[model samples]
Target: MSTVKDVTFDLLRRLGLTTIVGNPGSTEEPFLKDFPKDFDYVMALQEASVVSLADGLSQGLRKPVIVNLHTGAGTGNAMCAILTAYLNKTPLIITAGQQTRDMLLIEPMLTNIDATSLPRPWVKWAYEPARAQDIPAAFMRAYATAVQQPAGPVYLSLPLDDWDQPMDATDVLRTVSTRVGPDPARVTEFGARINAAMAPVLVYGADMARGGADVWADGIALAERLGVPVWASPFCERPPFPETHPQFAGPLPPAIAPLSALLKGHDLIVVIGAPVFRYYPYVPGSYLPEGAELLQVTDDPDAASKAAIGDSLVSDAGLFLKALLPQVNARVAFAGGPLRKPPQTPTGELPLTPAAVYATLNALLPDDFVLTQESPSNIPQLQDQIRVRKPDVSYAFASGALGWTTPAAVGLALAERQSGRNRPVLCVMGDGSFQYSIQGVYTGVQQKAHLIYVVLQNEEYGILKEFAELENTPNVPGLDLPGLDIVSLGKAYGANTSKAETTEELAGAFKGALDHHGTSVIVVPITRALRGLLG
Candidate 1:
């Protein structure tokens, strides 16, 4: 007979989870007893920061990451970050220590009102094993569920008392099977329809990256052969195509009305990996253009099933791309006009422009660096000024959640270090969002990870100002942030800091920070009035 701790460690090792991220609590002491020397534990101050770090590691490493948490309270604390992981479709196996198996019936202290339902709709699977012997198998199941198509987070509630109980550990580890290609007839029909269309647009999603660059290149080849322009899905977490490619049409419009209007002239809209479109609130428009037809190819069954206006085929993105490659005839030449350029920044001295900052940063950053963007007001500017090379190098919170960038950057830095990669991790976060998880800076400092945090100090919730103006509301509450020193905050977290009021100063600071060995923060003073231009 083996103790639960031994069994859990074995399961984790077999599952390739040598790294664990968590904020340990009193209830988790039993599980933490006799911690294995082979595994590395990444400790964060808050549970939300723990999960967020794990999320970024998963995306950067392209592997399932394990996260531990305290009981109900810890799970609740991590819920927002968990939602962000779900939206980003990151593969994570999250485990939380329950109060105790024996005390569960008595509703003891720190016991959740409903443990399984707490992470609702965010996790692919949530469970509490009935027997102590079942813990190992349950862990394996969580890993499998997390890595399955439409990869996302899974939860397990581990009772503390059960860790000391005897349990058998005889189950062998098994490899998860990859998804097969779509039906041959369906592929043929899709190819034929695409060839028949006058103007077909290819919208690539993040899933394309899951299949790797070879698959992505194959898809791009097919699209090019068909004379189609490739556009990234709205709010895309991955780069559907190399932004440097001539065929790339850049990111889709955030508003549905404008997006629908843009697609009006196209005869066929073929979306791959991503959904038809993701819209924000108050975005009014029909699902599709009046005469245009829609088609979807995705590895995610949910995305395929829920498509409002398209024929969907469920299959591995790479396999589908390979199978469809030979069926389409090559066009004489790819046909597409110049890509749409985002609004430009005006030269100024009084108020700083977000566009200028992004443009300068783009010029300053090396080609190999990774960027984690959380500045909602600078979306258009960054997307326009900085062209991404691939999906793996860029990440943004799809759930519209603030405070995700700080911790996520820590995770990416950790993953990069673990993989022996030398590229710098650049995190662009707004002043408002950075305050949410600034504690993560300490984690980066502790790990001695190479990270540069660029705080876009706009001194207010710029998005709210846009909302207020949109609604014609004159006065808004809680929109202004004044007299805050972000440089001091970074210093408090043990990070090297710099403040830049102009583009030239910012460029100098960014260049210096990128070469720093440890974590560094650069504060760029921006103006609230420049926010609207990014839209």
Candidate 2:
């Protein structure tokens, strides 16, 4: 006489989705009722925060995490956050409570009128179970869809009244292969293409970073043996290679013209684990330099199909690296300016510069600390100043969505505790982006997630203003954001707060926050300067 909830709980327990993450509503109570004592529930005040938090947790754990949302309203709230999860290639099983089956004829209040379609184009699969007895099977399908290659979030809507009406729950678990072995012929062909190119470059993307230490070693081996320069993919959510390495060229500009120009001299561009290009602000030009050819290796078939210019091989990044490594011939040495010239260090006068802020952070931060960045205006500055050398230690919203980082930081801190890694987390956010998921501060405090938030208040949407200048659009209003008191906001949520306007103050505040085992916000007012839209 096992109920649907009972069978589902057992399945969830077996799946290691024992810790449920989300913001639930009345419709969800039936599924969550008398929540199992062995399971834990992580709640967020906003639906968007919940989704992103789950994303971070999943990425940190390197596993599929389950999240619960309230039917239509919650799903809508989390749509953009869900998109970030999708682009990040993080595995997530998203479940929503639906209106009772009996009430569907009348379309009752809180009913997900179009539940199945609401999260479309972002989620891989979205379904509302046909019957109460089918809930457990639907969950199984959702999990399988989510964790498969090109891992991403999948959705399932369960009617509120369906939790108790279930019968069979005997044998439902199945093992599935999450990685695809590289085709030996394709691998040989890809290696041949690499070996044929005279002047080649490697562009590492987020998925390569997702492979952690083992894959990073293989990537380094491949690059050194090929005697080629390495560039991180533009606008990558996670940088694939160590920034401070000798062969590292700086990040490729995330615009069409500039990206093409940067790769102008290179005859072949080999992109691994990232899109061929991810651009913003519509920079039109050739997809590649005049004589250059492009090859993309990625797990996501969608990325390969959508690439504007590239020969693609769909394979697991780690396996592809290992398979291709031995076939390529070693070169004497890369014969060009192997690394791109870095921008000159900024000298500060009175108001703070973006580079100065990042430089101070870089100088003072410990090597082991994790950085979650969402400061859009200062992305290039931070990437240049900060060296991301470790795998799964740096994260940004792949979808270019704000509000995901702060909550993500909290979730990552929680994951660190669970894994006993317990590396301190540092979240760098723009003041404008901070307010988008400000409620994350409360969640951090409640969950005892020790994270330090460094919010740079530039008194404007600086990146947008840069975009305005580039796009030559006149009189775009709402570009300036003024009168935000992040210190007060942080304090209201029971977090330790500080304001650091000077370098000395910044160092002290950062150290103090780092030493404390709780949530802290260090707000800094920075002068606005545009580094161009592509940066």
Candidate 3:
């Protein structure tokens, strides 16, 4: 009889989970004892980075990736990242060690207390095997649940000593449907409505990109067929449509009243692959513009249910776009000039404006390069200034958390290697957000992951300050961070580092990072301006 570890590894290999991301501990040693030479283990310095790195890899690979953590303590460290993964809709199989079964009642060191509940609400499914032999079976369930429609993280707890347990292994390989197709009648009805409407606007989100290249093309084709203006969803975490497209009308504001006002002229508002609305700051107003009807297509039941007002079709974004394409007519409304003008490149000024940085990057960045951005205070400029010209080229935080993207840059670099695309990855982050997962740099160095970190150092939490102003709160303490040698820190993590105080220097630093094979950090001290939200 094969032992649990033997069978589990075989299963994992078959499932394409050969690369495991983890931050290990004593409780996890048994499972990792004599790790297979054929398998690769990506070790992060902290559990938070471990889970987050895996999240990026999963998204890049478009599959479920397994992550190992050190029992309860490790899970606690990774909870915030798990939440990020949940919001990102990335498929991850998260496994953690539980103290030996004999110590469960005694609650000894590293013994998980309520293990299943730890990652809950965030995870689609969470479970600890009922017995040692059940561990392999549990993983299968976890993988299936993780990749189902509206993919997200799943949790499993394995006892340390259970790896050696006797188990009779049999072929457990099976294939499951990963996408939910739109209901035929509902889709036909949606098509009819689109044809009947005199004016319709298409709003899209990350799912269009997540659905893969074919799906992204379908989105552009569908938009062409309908001849409708396209608006990006509020706080969209990925680029579904090329920002440079002529029909693109830019992003919609997140608040309720303004969001409706922007769509007011359209008789039909068709939102697909995103939530009906993702709003913030609690601006109360009509859910939809007067005389405008809304229809949403999404893979998530939760988003469909929580939608304030909309007729929803639960379906894969790509499938719905494909199905509705032939039913619609090619119209002349789309054959027009650009809906928005490109921001003019800024002139070099002292202590460069955020627009200058974005404009410089916009000019320098390669068409195929991938960008992960987290500079919240500079979003308005980043949006109007920077442009994504390719499909699946942008990613950002949906969980409103810091530190995810910096480490995610590393994972994306690894993903590039795995996929043989080897695209250069640039991570744009604020100074305050850099500290949250700085340890990820060390991991990147060890892995020789090639990426760049462009830090916009304003010496303060500009986003938080903006929020305070919006909320009428003042004199907030501990907002300023004046001292830190980021150059030294980057060097300590074995990265090439540079600082730029002028636009010319900034361009040089960015170019150096692009040419370098490994990690680099370019810190630029920008003008400190707290641009208010919706500015």
Task: Choose the strongest candidate by lDDT.
Answer: 3
Candidate 1 per-residue lDDT, tens place, 310-409, comes to 8999888888888888888777676555565544654665356877788888888887888888887777777777888665788777787887889989
The segments of candidate 3 whose C-alpha lies over 4 angstroms from its true place after superposition are none
- Specify the highest-TM-score model's number: 3
Off by over 4 Å in 1: 335-350, 530-534
Error of 1 at 466 (Å): 1.7
- In model 1, the worst 10-residue window by lDDT is 526-535
Clashes of 2: 0
Tell me how many residue pairs clash in candidate 1.
1
Whole-model Cα lDDT of every candidate shown, in order:
0.84, 0.88, 0.89
Tell me the lDDT of candidate 3. Answer: 0.89
lDDT of 2 at 514: 84
Models 1 onward score TM values of 0.96, 0.97, 0.98
lDDT of 1: 0.84
